[model samples]
Target chain A: MLAQGLTITISVLIASAFFGYLFAFIAGLCRLSKNVILRKFTGFYVEIFRGTSLIVQLFWLYYAVPMLFGIELGSNWWVGVIAIALNYGAYMSEIVRGSILAVAKGQTEAATALNMSRFQRMRLVIFPQAVRMMLPEFGNYLIQMLKATSLVSLIGMHDILYYGDILRSSNLSQAPTVYLLVLVFYFILALPLIFLTRKMEDISKKGVASQ
Target chain B: MIEPIVTFNDVHKSFGDVKVLKGIDLDIKPAEKVAIIGPSGSGKTTIIRMLMTLEQPTSGDIIVDGKNLWKMEKKGSMVDANEKHLRNVRGDIGMVFQHFNLFPHMTILENCMTAPIHVKNEDKSTAKQRSIEMLEKVGLGDKLDNYPSQLSGGQKQRVAMARALVMRPKVMLFDEVTSALDPELVGEVLEVIRDIAKEGEMAMILVTHEMDFALDVADKVLFLDEGVIAEQGTASEVIEHSTNERLQSFLHRFRS
Candidate 1:
């Protein structure tokens, strides 16, 4: 009776982080790549995902992708992970690309003059600087990403919002009361992220100031 | 006299249809100090940029330390040299830009150490010691751990010089090295440049707008006008009192 909305909310947050980061890594590399086709495809993918509604993407992945492929991805937990990741990753790639470019060109030249290859330059100089620049943006994206997880309930993913929906239909609680508790549950799931983002912002601000 | 440490012969460069550098020939003996002074858009910076390999030339060879730098074919032709060859040649030539181009994310010490570690593949302790010696020479030893933004413009440029010098390059190409400094800050940076000039083993080519520093410290001076050498002589003849009308007009502008 007391299952409440806790399990559903935890599952969504965990699912988003694990998958969202993978997409961000792949998409970020794709966006930064020299291959014209890879760059354009990643650019197009980001645009398509960012241009359309998140709910549509989720529905397409869950309902359309499996049917198109003629495979059973419905019961797959990994599918939920991939869906959330690709959706948020499109936005995160942009953040990563901008941050990497924001690092001064001189550092790369210095590295080149020192005989470091492009790959080594990116890993040692450019990427580290980009990470520092992108941390604030990443934290912001993480919070938004966490909130976006609630949309999974529509796909019948057993998310916190779905739990609340079931509670609302049950007689143990009044409809209005059950609906109210779900809102509180979302706030519970989302508030910590907001606070965490704010904390990250403060720390990075100090880092920039000290520099 | 045995062989010029650097040679630029019939060099040509163009940006689109706009020719920035016309046919050019120059030579620098080992340990020679040469300064190039010119009007704005006369391509003083471009010459240094080409030497630094920041921009490739449209045609011609740039031989430095007695090798065809603009090309790599054994039979004498331009090269689409691999990154490895480019890096090797670049390692021998160090450049100080007009705007101090220090990496903002790193400490002043790390800024100097980056090449010694990443490029030279020196061990951490050895590179650290060498970089510290360089930072001390440029007077940034106290601010080793501070990032570039925390330092003044002048300090960052000093760190830039230290970073360049740590590699112990055979040739140092300076592109208006102190132009970005505040009037008051220019002297310290120039003093460091003069100090490098004193060492006298490295071939130094300085492009500068500071007429006095060019005349005072440059062994040879070239007055460039509209992408060609308008006049050339020892610093005293070309800069102090030249017969060329174009040179006189240029000096008058600086003097008066």
Candidate 2:
């Protein structure tokens, strides 16, 4: 049962993070668009998600949204993933936008001097450099987003914390051990990500500094 | 007389309330080498930047090879050129910046080949060959695989020149290309520019502080002051023989 819960938790984390990055790039680019409508619409989205409480958003999507819209989100996990991704993606988009803007003015000027179109300049010159700049911040958000995934268990998603709750209630005497095991599981899950972030930071430093 | 390759007719540029360039007129002929010398705020760099399409002139016309650079004919009337129009007009011109803005993520060879392959649609092998040849010409043939961060300032500047030269531009603009280099490293970068100027294939405009270099490579020299061309003549005539009081005071600082 604990293994099943762990599997479900990992699946939701992966799904949310994937969709989160997709939404981030889209909204970030939209915010920088020349069209007023696109910029305004994306700005509204970022504000709506960023201003609200994460748990309230998850609850609204899982419970209130179905009643209001008369639409089924299909699974409890789907609602949890959607809410978390939307909220986190809003925050990450700012990271994306800031990183892209931080690229040196001289780089863009050089691209223009080479006769590159706007699209080519962004794709070939600007984005490649910006991605390296984004990695350390993205890694921070990844860890925070991982811890936030435990909130899904409150909505009956059967995540690790949910199973831990069940075990603690049945054997009150083992509650401390059960909670300790739960803490260990989370730390174990986070270890690889921490390692990966460090590796990325090192590579980025080498990319920027002298060999 | 040879036709002028580029003509600036009454060009004016302003940044907000401050006028940077005031009613400038200039011409660059094919295969001509011109150097512009000026103090920090005299708008020498802005002139080359406007010609490169990095900055737009507020008022006036820039004609490149008989085509308007900042204006395009729309339904038989002149209108501000769009990005496509500006890109098309500026395709024949290339510029090297003061900072030698080579792409950090790419190896030097990739930097040289990227514009040719993407913008010009050259085949990979052909682009690679041409890039290698250009790198060799700049004396960086062995460092093709090195990234910009790995190279010294002089080497990076050479790579930048190779990147600009690979496009086979008809006009090359160098905007104080040695300004950021270490004093010891400046000579190497200047040596490469001198070699290119010797070939005399494309017209070159150099905005520089090196008066001696200006005399060596440029056939014509313009001294800009107060957002206007204060004097213009052959390099020696302007540098050694000019008696304008303002110009003499400017040259005195460089002499010591």
TM-score of chain A of each: 0.86, 0.96
Please report, as a residue range, the 10-residue window in candidate 1 chain B with the lowest summed lDDT.
B74-83
- Model 2, span A62-130: residue lDDT tens: 889899999989899898889889999999999889878888888899999999999999999889888
Off by over 4 Å in 2: A208-211
lDDT of each residue in B30-58, candidate 2, tens digit only: 99999999889999999999999989999
Native contacts kept, each candidate: 0.37, 0.78
C-alpha TM-scores of all predictions: 0.92, 0.98
In angstroms, give how far residue B168 of model 2 lies from its true place. Answer: 0.4
Q: What lDDT is obtained when candidate 1 is compared to the true structure?
A: 0.79
Worst 10 residues of 2 chain B by lDDT: B97-106
The lDDT of each candidate is 0.79, 0.92
Candidate 2 similarity to native, TM-score: 0.98
Error of 1 at B98 (Å): 1.5
